[model samples]
Target: MGKLYVVGIGPGGFEHMTFKAKKAIEESDVIVGYTKYIDFIEPLIKDKEVLSTGMKSEVERAEKALELAKDKVVSIISTGDAGIYGMAGLILELKKDEEVEVIPGITASSSAASILGSPLMHDNCNISLSDLMTPYDLIKKRVELATQGDFIISLYNPRSHGRPHYLKECIDIIKKYRKGDTPIGVVKNALRDGQEVTLTTLENFDDTIVDMFSIVIIGNSGSYIKDGMFITPRGYKL
Candidate 1:
């Protein structure tokens, strides 16, 4: 049997990608991933056999990667950290009992947090608003629970063309538990090209501007915006 390496390319930026992730992609005989994600690693896999599929074909990508790994070293790339809402879980679930290595990279939450200052300095939880696989009811419950717990919430897949109203619904749920003035940071394409960061409040949030590429970070009660930075205090008394 050959080897399989699932790699996280880190928000489509070479600087954000881990050394091991780059190495795995460099050494692999075949690279497989989503079409956009494959484009991110284009320079590295120019000479290798690349296989890619469009949206909602994750299972097909994972199975193809496993099939290619039977006799060749295959590296399946996922944006951000592969284990967190990435392809790592699916790949491992299908390839159970086989050897696979997951190489980590900077996730969108951490990358966006860094760009927006220290919004994640305190306790935080990540919730994706996408209901492609997870039901909308469950996603809403998670958002409500995370808000009630006062955890800094990082929302992935916050809005899309199909589910334009989901983010607004989630923000409404958070407003019930937290103040309307709670800080909300929106980062699009994080460290990649055409990056945009907007700092607003729960009351002022405009979900129309958010898309699948954006990450929305909601701050806790203690969080504040100072000098254009979103900060969640970690009890560091001055």
Candidate 2:
């Protein structure tokens, strides 16, 4: 049996690719990923055969990687940490006989948090606003609980085309438990070219900028902005 490396490529950029991830891509005979994600690493996998597909094809993508692993070393790439909202789940779901090695990279949330300061230093929770697989009511409940619990939230897939206002709705829900002046930071293309970070408040979140590639972090009541960055106090009085 050949080796299968499930590598996380970090956010969309060559610089964000870790040394291990790059080496895996360089040594692999086959590369598999979503089309856009595959394109991000295209330069690194010049001689390999790439299998790309559209959204919602994760299961098929995983199967393809497994099949390719029958003879040659295959690298299945994902954006951000493969375990967090990446292809890791799909690969695991379909995994049966193969010994797959998972290589983690900087997740978008962590990168976003780093760029916006250390808002995740204290108790924090990562939430995906996308209700495609999860019910909205359940998501709302979690949002409410996270807000009331005073936990910093890292929101993924906050907004999309048809659900253009879903993020606004989430903000409205968060406002119910958080103060209107709660610090909310938006990080786009984190660690990549054209990276932008916007620090705003819950009340004025609508007026701020956002995109599909953005990660929105809403700090708890105890969170504050210091030295141009959002920091959540972990109860350590200095």
Candidate 3:
């Protein structure tokens, strides 16, 4: 029987990739992932056969990986924690009669949040602004609730070419339940070269920098900053 390894490469740096992930890729006969992610790990692949796809073809990619895994050892690479909006979901959705193993990696949100201090230490939720599969209204409702409940938010897919204004819309929704002065931090290409980190307020988020590789963190009501890092303690007093 063949085995499938769902590996997380971690935010986009060689150092961030775990030892196990490297070994798995080296041992695997085939590697599959998005083009950008594949490029990030190309040097490690050597002569291994690689199958890369463009954006939004996750289901197809997962299916193809599973098909290949039926006959050979396959590794499907995910950028961050495989469970966090990664290829894990789509792989499980299409997997059947196969032995699959998920190897976890540092999620971008956690990595970015750590760099900005503990903005995610307390009650928090993650939201992806991309409306590719989820509806806008649902995202808006979640944003409203998250804002009202004073939960820290780790936003993924904040900006892309097709959805240029989605992040701004999300910011507007957050502002409705929170103050304009709420702290927000944007971390792009965390752990990778040319990484950029921006600290701003909810009101000024639109004027700041953003990109597809960025993770935007919106602090809660009691969140604060120290030494240029945003922090939201886990309310142990409450």
Give the alpha-carbon lDDT of every model.
Answer: 0.92, 0.87, 0.87
Query: Could you tell me how far off, in angstroms, the CA of residue 178 lies in candidate 3 after the best superposition?
Result: 1.8
Clash pairs detected, candidate 2: none
Candidate 2: stretches off by over 4 Å: none
What lDDT would candidate 3 get against the real structure?
0.87
lDDT of candidate 2? 0.87
Model 1 scores a TM of 0.98
Top-TM-score structure, candidate number = 1
Per residue, candidate 3 scores C-alpha lDDT tens digits across 78-174 of 9998888898888888899887889889998888987787888888899998888899899888888888988899899888888888888888888
TM-score of each: 0.98, 0.95, 0.94
Top lDDT hit: 1
Worst 10 residues of 3 by lDDT: 200-209
What's the candidate order when arranged by decreasing TM-score? 1, 2, 3
